[model samples]
Target chain A: MRPSDIAFRLYLVALFTFVFLPILTSMVFSLNSDRFPTVPLGEFTTHWYKTAFSRPEVWTAFGNSLIVAVCAAALSTALGFVTAYTDFRYGFRFKPAYLALALLPPTIPLVIMGLAMLAWLGRLGISGTLSGIVVAHTVMGAPFAMAICRLRLSQMDPALEAAAWNLGASQWRAMRAVVIPFCLPALISAYCLTAAVSFDEFIVAWFVSGLNKTVPVMILEILQGNVDPQINAIGTVVFLTSMALVIVAQLLILRKTNA
Target chain B: MTDTDPLVRFSGVRKTYGTFEAVKHLDLDIGRGEFVAIMGPSGCGKTTTLRMLAGLEEPTAGEITIDGKRMNEVSAHDRDTPLVWQSLALFPFLNVKENVEFGLKMRGVSKPDRHGRAMLWLERLGLKGFETRRIDQLSGGQRQRVALARSLVTEPRMLLLDEPLSALDAHLVIRMQGVLTRLQKELGITFVYVTHSQSEAFAMADRVVIMGHGEIAQIGKPQEIFRAPKNRFVAEFVGRNNILPGKTPGQEIVVAADRMQVSASDPGEGALPAEFLSEEFAGTGIICYFEGPEGVELKAQVTEDQLENLAPEPGQRFWLTWAPGAAHVMAGT
Candidate 1:
């Protein structure tokens, strides 16, 4: 191989190693029968996995995270699709402003967004509840869903929906028959992405999820209490879950539409 | 409605987007079972007129009636005017058969009935075996036929076609034109076709409507529009005609290109002097352009034998005279 090609391949290898090494280290530690993670070889065992899952609080946290992710993904995807359809189908005054406001939440710093949600949901009396965490995640995730859906909608022929209407489909029927079917891939991708986002989120859930701890929140709590091997086991599970969701989302969005 | 009652009519119809008028004072009557083509340049409001008739666009100030029923506020889906778009706009996600059955599905027709009708149209358009194929798998012409079948499956009383053949190859365009004309004749439905192509409009249309600046320049049989254009715009837009100014003020005359004779020598009385500029090869004749008096351009279509006899060169002086009784005086300035 040419020297430049070899160098580029090495760079890519280094980049992936840098990204995955920490997760790989945690996975290795999750199986090691040791109190602390170290370079010296330790006997591999499932002791930490058993220990972490045995706790009722840990199980509750995992359940809460799943619930938040599903609810947040559904709510955000609905919001995103409506926002995208509005942008696609209408040409009203201040359209740019409408889009900016719709997509503005993600541009804010996560800490600030967390703080704002804590305060807003507090006034609504839903803070510290699982519903509050779901709402906060939905706000953060809607913009992503909106971006994906908007990209798909932009690629559509502007006349497709109108053609449906011309062929005896009313406005709602046209949406069901044409626009929704065309955006289905984007919708599913957005759902997976928002679900991953909500599942992995820690800061906003920490702010608003008062009593019901999500997985990330529980992991932090466990870390604050002590640096234990069980944290490594939980961390590996969290990482795998997020990665699975993200990979599915990526494949859905990148696939060539045979339509 | 009776065949002579006119299938569609527009009276004092005007459509304006803010300060820009897309269609101004359109008064047209499309007869039943007629093939009418609206020809114009881009942004000449031909599309807007079709959209209005299809209930996609509301007229600013007038009445549009389909079969004597006022249809100003009828929504698009409620109207039976199915339109074939310029882009075809077939649903990419749906297979060929599903796309054709869309209108029937929307109308809540039974599944088997929709399938039978869709198949009938697909077969009629010569797309029988490819029913289950994805839209992307089909060729451009096949997709075009799919779009036609999709619109025609509804068996509406009228069809609105917006530049449907403009995307086809020249040879394919000729083939599709024959297909479209044959289908229109067999269906005996009113076909409102909008096109910017002079030949497409002239070749297939029983009546050609020339639109310019959102107004009807002239509406007549293609041959009549070719033989006698009503005004300067009509004459110029229709093309291949020499529009000349009469000696009297505010008078203009239109002479067909074939009727104009180009002679090397002065032909005595009523001979107009012209200088040959260039010639374009038209299959049957050579269309010669000349710089005439008052700086107006004149066109004359001459046969190969006539061209060889004169042996005309660019910038060669010639006398222009028309056949007796061929000059038509245009109405209005």
Candidate 2:
């Protein structure tokens, strides 16, 4: 190879090592025979993986994360689909403001929104519950869903729905028949993205989840106390699962955009 | 004028957007089964009139009646008139058969019957084997056929087309003209077509309504509108013409321009011609220009064969005459 090509390859290798070295280290340490995460290299073992799975607290946290993710994804995607459709079809005054509001959550600082949600939910007697966490995740996740759905809705053939209406389809029927089918891929991508965001979210979940511990919050708690290698084992699992979810979401979005 | 009862009437129909009147004080009567074409420049209310007739738009002041029944209050779905939009408006997701059967399904027809009718329409439109084909898989012409099948399957009382062939290529537009004219005659359904092309209107319509500046400029058969226009706008809009000013006597509109030719049979007592200035040979005919004493040029289309007999050259003197009744009077700014 040429000298430049060799340099470029070395640069790529350095980049990957910088990003993934800690993750690899964590995985290897999680399989250590010893209890301490970083004392010394020991014989390879799977005890931490087993210990992490046997813990009831871990399972409860995982269950709470799953519930919040599912509820947030469902609510955000549903509301996004409706809002995008309305924005596209019947434009009104302050449309720009509504669109800006929908996009604000993703750009703003998460801690501020999390604290605001906590205060608002406390006033409404809805804080310190699984429902509150779900609400917080949904609020944060909606901007992503709305933006994706709006992009898809704007690209759809407006004449198709008009054709349906002219052919005797009622307004709702036209939406169901023509608009929904065309927008299905966008809807799926938005759902996947919202689900991933809700599942992996930490800061907002920490504020809103109160007594209900999510997987991320539980992981943080474990990391603060001891150098248990089980944290590494569970972190590896989350890292892999999140990687898979993100890859799936990207594939869905790419397929939808190409289609 | 032939029938006393107007099959479809627009009684003082008008459409206004804020201060701009898209259509103004329009009154027209279309006979049953008559193919009428509305022609105008863009934004001239021809399309607006057709949309009003189809109930896609409501008039600002007047009422529209179809077959003697008031239609101003009816929704487009209940109006029994289908408008073929300028964009073909075929559902991209639905296959040919489903798109055709959409109207039937919405009207709650039985599955078997709706399929049967849809198939019949597809076959009639020469798309028999393409029932399962997606819209994107079809050619431009084929898509137009599918659009027509979908509209006709509803069995509308009158079909309204808004520049339906404007998107097609030149050859396809000509082909569609034949298809549309034949289909209209074969089905014997009333058709209200809107177009900006006078050639298409002349080729298909039994009567052509020419509009300008949101008002009816003239309404007549294509031949009448072509041979004798009601006003300058209609004359300029319908076909190629060379307009000349003339004074009307009791029985004659005297042409005193030098760019005209008159037969000896037109007596000098009623007709006058100044001098022929120039001549242009236009294949089958010649257009001769005349400059009058009033300093305005006049023109006449004379056959090349007729010119050979007269042996007329530039600056040839002749008289031009037309009977008083031949010219239709009109007013415009």
Candidate 3:
């Protein structure tokens, strides 16, 4: 290879290493039998993984996280699809304002959002519950879903829907048959991404999930008490699962767009 | 529909979007089973008029009637008028068969019947073997045929085409034009085709509607409109006509360059001073370019026989003349 090509490849390797080094380190340390994470290798064992899997608290928190993530993902995706479709297909007053508001959640700090939601949910008498956590995660994750779905909707030709309407389909039927199908891949990708975000989310869950601790909040609590190798194993599992979800979503989007 | 009743009628129809009037005081009558083409430059409201007929756009004033029924408030889906979009707009996710069956499916047709009808159209449009192929897998012409089949399967009262063949290659355009004409005749359906190409409009339409500045400049048979344009805009837009300053009885006149006969006699007050610039041999004839009075560039279509007889060269000063009756006189010209 040319010198420039070698330099470029090296640069890319450095970038990847920089980004993935922490996750790689964590994965390696999860397999180590050492009490504290260190560079020098200790005896390798699956004891921490077994401990993590066997714990009832861990299983409960994992179950709670799954429920919140799934619910949040579905709600956010549906809300995003509605907002994106309406904003794109119709003309209304203060449209920019509406879009800006829809996109505001992702821009604000998660801590601020969590605190605000805690106060809001307290007034509604749903604070410190699974439903409150789901609501909080939906609010946090929806902007990402909306952003992706909006992009897909914007790229779509409005004439497709028009053709459907011209072909004797009512406006609702046209959207159901043509527009929704066209945006399905993006919607799926958005759902997967929001689910991943909700799975890994900590601050909002910490504020709103009072009795029911999500996996991230549980991990934070465990870390605060002691630097257990079990925490490393659980973190590795959560990180890998979130990464897998995001990759699957990305692949689906790419396949649909043929990009 | 009877011969006396117009299938579609636009009476003083006006459409305004905010401050801009897209179509103004338009009156048109489209007969049953007639193929009418609306032609104009961009922003001349030809597409808007077609959309209004299809109930995609509501008229700001006046009335639009289909078979004597008012269509002012009817939605596009309820109106029995389908449009073949310029972009074709085939659903990319659906295969060819599904795309063609979509209209029928929307109307709640059973699966077996929808499949049979879609297959028939696919075969008729020469897309038989490509049934299960995705829209992205088809060629431009094939996709166009699918779009046509998708619209026609429902058997709407009228089919509106908005520059449907604009994206195809020139050769494909000609082939599709013939295909569209054949389909229209076979189906015997009223067609409202909107295009900017004069040749496409003239070739397929029974009558042509020429629009300018959001109003109809002229509406007549293609031959009539070509031979006798009502105004300067129609004359310039419809065909290659060299408009030049001239005079006729009781009206201000301009002579078409091709009709300007060169004569040795004094051509009178109607004649204008002009100098020959260039001549182009266009296979069957020659197009002679000239610089007229006040630097007006003019064109003249000279036959091969005329070119041989006259043998006019560049820089030739001549009295361009024509019979007064042959001159097309425009009002307020």
Candidate 4:
């Protein structure tokens, strides 16, 4: 091609390389056999992965994070379903205020939310437990779920519900048969995103988790003292799982919008 | 009207949204096995009244009785009134058979029975081979028929349709009208329909109920409502009709508008001369517009054969006349 076009192509290639090199380097280091992670010449081994797998503390943290993610996702999705349906279908006097209230938690800073949750739960003598972490994650995640589900609800035909009602179906049945099916993709996406957000979350979980270490918190602890092979292996696992969840969520979002 | 008791009765039924009354206090009786079309302008409470009858909305006042049962407290599902929506509202996720079976399934019908009934209706609606097809896969008319099959599968006593043909193409609309009329006849069920198009109301309804400002303006057979409109609103709304203001000298009143002065032998009291404005050809008839002395533009339809004798022109003034019994005068607003 032309000189300028070649130069522009080179620039794009450099930008792509800059963005992807670090991730590639990390993946390479994660498999390195040396005590200190290094470039290009280290022997590859599966020992770190095995060590990471066998570590009870790491597994416990992973399990804790999984549980917190699942419960938070389920709670957020349920609340979002209700919020979207209520806002779309009914005319309540406080709709604006209610919407603002639902959105408040997400707009607030995570640090502030974490601190507030710590204080509130401590006041009730319930701070730093798994349940407290779940509550915090659910509160933080619900707004995102609500936004996604609301968009889905807005795109759907209101006549679907009305049709069901006219066909001798109750409001509940209409929701179940018509409305819910239309919103399913959004609901699934919201759940996945909520789960992924809770899984990767550090600040909020750190404050509300007390002695119960989530995967992020455990990774942070492991990285602080030394650069262990086990840490790299655990990081790789977390990165893979998060990527999978995010990809699934994005696909669901695409389907929902297109449909 | 038939001698059989009315299947659905509305006595002073009204519904209001906040301060906006959608359906004013109104009375109507739909006889058993009758196809009744509720017709009106937009915001005239036709759909609102249908919703109230379907138990989707509760009346602010008055009573609705269906099959000798007070329906105010009954839920939508138990009302057994199926409504065919203008959008069809077929469940996109469900295939044709499943969509048709949805209502019966919700009512806890056994699986085999639901499928059997759904298949029966689907076959009856000429959709037997397409039962496995998704809603999006069907053509517009086909989707409409699927919606009908779904509603009819439940064998409801009354069917309420809210402008079901408004979304279809003109050709499809006419075809669907025939299908709907035949279905209603064969099922022998009460059909309460709401529409804003006068042609649809005229073509399909055994009786037409015209609404305005959330109240019933006139209720009668298609021919009756079209031939003898009770007031200026119904006259203008039912079809093209020429109206002019005229007063009776003794028993005879002269209505002059659009170069036509017609005299009514029994013109009602307070009739006066109305100004004639314009005229337009409408295929089978010609519509002449006039502004009555009351400042109301009135429309009148003259058939093709009648156009020859009158020989209407823009400003050529002629006497406007109608039989005394032909004019229906309303009370002063």
Candidate 5:
């Protein structure tokens, strides 16, 4: 091949290696029998996995994280779809401002957002609960969902909804019959992405998930208590959960149609 | 309304986008089962007029009535006027059978009944055995037939078409024109078609309404408009005719291209001096462009045999004349 083609291939390999090498190392060390993570001498074993699973707190944290991720994903996708549809279907004086507001949450610093949510939920008397973490994650995750749904809506034929109405479908009926089906791929993608975000989030969960520690929060505590080998086992599971969710999300929307 | 009365009427209707008027005050009456074509240049409010009739746009000023019922407040879904869009707008996510049955399903028709009716239309439109095929798999003409079937399956009293054939091949457009005309006559339903094409309108419409600049320039049978345009705009837009500045001020003469004959030598008195400019072959006929006195531009149609006999080249002097009564004097222009 040409020199530029060879360079491009090398760039891709380097990029993927940079992104995945840390995860691969964690996976490898999770099975190693060595006390400290080092190269060239450890035996392969499932000792860390057994140690991580035996702790009852890790089980509790896993359960808490799963519930928060599910609830947050559902709420974020629902809110995002509405926000996207409103942007797609309406024209008004402040439309640009409205869209900017809809997409604003993701741009805010996570620490500031986490603090704001902690304060707000404490005032509402649900602070330090699983519900508080769910609420906080929903706010942080919604803009990503909205961005995905907006891209899908842009690809849609603008006249499809109007054509449905012209064919005798009522407003609600057209939404069900045309708009929702057209955006189904985007909705599932958004759900998966938001679930992955909530499942793997750290800074925000560390602030609001007080007694109800999620997997990331548990991993941090384990790491700080000592440089525990058990951290690798939990980190591998977290990596797999996130990778599976992300892959599913990408597959749903990236399978091109003859548009 | 009685059988003799108009099925749709627009009285003092006006539509504006902010300060720009898309359709000025308009009054029109469409008889039952009539095929009417509204045509104009782009941005000439032809589509605005069609959209108003279909209840997609609420008129800014007066009223639109379908069969004596005021439709100013009627929502688009409540109207039976199904429009065949220029883009076809077929749902890519839905298969052919599902797309065709969408209207009936929304109207709460039973599943078996909807399926039977949809299948009947699909077959009628020559789309048999393609029911389960996805929209993206169909050809352009097949998708067009699908759009027609979807709109017609509702069996509405009237149908609206907005330049629906603009995207087809020339031969396919001609074929679809035949399909549309035959369907209109067979179903005995009013078809209000909007286009910018003169040929499509004249070929299929019983009457043609020519619009320009948000107003009706003229409305008449195609032959009448061809023979006698109400004004200069209709004269220029509808047919390829020689519009001449008459002998006196405030007068214009319109001669159909076919009516004027060309010759190398002077024919006699009343024959005009002209110079041949260019010629274009149009099927069996050739359109020979000429320039007259005072730089007046004109065109004459001659058969290929006639063009050979004349053998006029660019800048060749010729005599252009017509029968006295063949030229129409458009009074206002």
Candidate 6:
């Protein structure tokens, strides 16, 4: 191989190793029998996995996270699609201001957002509930969904919708038949990305989730109390799930553009 | 016009966006089964006019009627006017048959009936065996045919084409022009085609409407517009001509380059002196360039016979003349 090619390959390997080493270490330590994660690993065991799965709290937290993620994904994607379509198709005063406001949630500090949501939801008497967590996650995830969907919508040719309308389809029908289908790939990717974001969100859930604890919040609590190997197991699982969702989203976007 | 009653009429139509007027107050009439082409430079409101007629845009201050029925409030879906877009706008996700069946499906036609009709159009457009192929899989010409099929399957009363052939190669554009003319003739439907190419408009339209600055400059038969333009703009835009200040009152005369005669006779009074610049052999004839008085550049197309007879050379001076009736005079100097 050429010297430059060998150097480029080495750079890629180093980058991947640097990025993935934390997750790989966590997964390896999850399988270790040692109470505390150490340099020289103890005997390998599946006991922590069994213990993590056996806990009812873990199962409940997992279910809560799934529900919140699914609901948040659906809500954010729908809101994003509508907002993006409107922004792309219409001209109005203060459009930039509206878009900037829609995007503010993702740019704000998570701790500040969490505190604000806690205070707001407390006044509404829904603080620390599943609905509160879902709402918080939806707000946190929507900016990302809207950004991706808006890019796709902007790239689309408006003539397609015009063509549909010319062919006897009403505006709504044309959007349903043409615009929605054309934006489907981006929408699906947006949904997956938002689901992953909601599943992994920690700070907002920590603040707004009252009695109903999400998996991330529960994981934070467990880590605070004790550095149990069980936490490592669940962390590895969560990391893998988020990674899978992100990879799927990227693949979908790539496939659509290439097609 | 065969039908005395107009099929489409625009009475005092005007459209504006913010402070920019896209279409000025206009009046026009289109008879049934007439092929009308709107031709202009870009941003001259040709496409905007077509869009308004298709109900894509509503005029700010006027009424449009089709078949004597007011269309001011009718939405695009309810209007039986289909448009063929310049980009073709074929749905990338749908197969050929589904694309063609889209209109029928929207109208709530049953599956079997829409499918049969779509198939017939596909066959007619020479896409019979390619019904199930995805739109992205087709060639440029095939995609254009699919777009036409999709629009025509609905059997619209009038068809609007917005520079549909602009994206094709020159050879393909000519071929498609023939196809479009034949299709319009066979269907006997009013076809309002918008294009920037004067040749395309002249070749296909029964009457050409030339637009300038969001307003009609002139509307006439192709031959009339070419041979006898109404003004300096139409004269310059429609055909190659030399426009010069006329000797008569309130008149600017346009003389075709090929009709100017070069002679060695004594120059008469008011005969403009000119210096020969260059001559280019343009396949069938020679184009002689001259710098005339007042720095006005003049072009003359000399036939092969004329070139042989005169044998004009570079740097030669000659008096250019033409018959009095050959100059087409406009109202303003």
Assess every candidate by TM-score.
Answer: 0.96, 0.81, 0.94, 0.86, 0.98, 0.94
After superposition, which runs of candidate 1 have C-alpha atoms over 4 Å from their true positions? A1-4
Pairs that collide in candidate 2 are B258-B275, B258-B290, B259-B289, B259-B290, B262-B319
**Quality class of the docking in candidate 2, CAPRI style:** acceptable
Better of 1 and 6 by lDDT: 1
Positional deviation of residue B302's Cα in model 3 after best superposition, in angstroms: 3.1
Docking class of 1: medium
Q: Give the CAPRI class of candidate 5.
A: medium
Relative to the unseen true structure, what is the Cα RMSD of model 4?
A: 4.8
In candidate 4, which residue ranges exceed 4 Å CA deviation?
Answer: A1-21, A33-47, A256-259, B1-3, B249-333
| Candidate 4 lDDT over residue span B89-165, tens digit each | 78888898999998898788999999899989988989989989987778889989998988888888878899988
Tell me candidate 5's TM-score on chain B: 0.98
The sequence of per-residue lDDT tens digits that candidate 3 reaches over residues B1-333 is 577799999999999999898998799999999999999999999999998998889899989999999999999988888789989888888999998998888889999999999999999999999999988888899999999998898887789999999999999999999999999999999999999998899989999999988899999999887777887888888655756544455554545556767643456886666788888876546878778888977777778887787677688876666676667666543
Most TM-score-accurate candidate: 5
Q: Distance (Å) between predicted and true CA of A128, model 4?
A: 3.5
Range of the 10 consecutive residues with the lowest summed lDDT in candidate 4 chain B: B250-259
Q: What is the lDDT of residue A240 in candidate 5?
A: 94
- After superposition on all C-alphas, the RMSD of every candidate to the true structure, in Å, is 1.7, 5.8, 2.4, 4.8, 1.3, 2.4
Worst 10 residues of 3 chain B by lDDT: B245-254
The positional error of residue A185 in candidate 6, measured at the CA in angstroms, is 0.6
| C-alpha lDDT score of every prediction, in listed order | 0.94, 0.81, 0.87, 0.81, 0.92, 0.87
DockQ scores of the candidates: 0.78, 0.36, 0.67, 0.57, 0.79, 0.69
The lowest-lDDT stretch of 10 consecutive residues in candidate 1 chain A is A250-259
Question: Which of the CAPRI classes, incorrect, acceptable, medium or high, describes model 4?
Answer: medium
Q: What C-alpha lDDT does candidate 6 achieve relative to the native structure?
A: 0.87
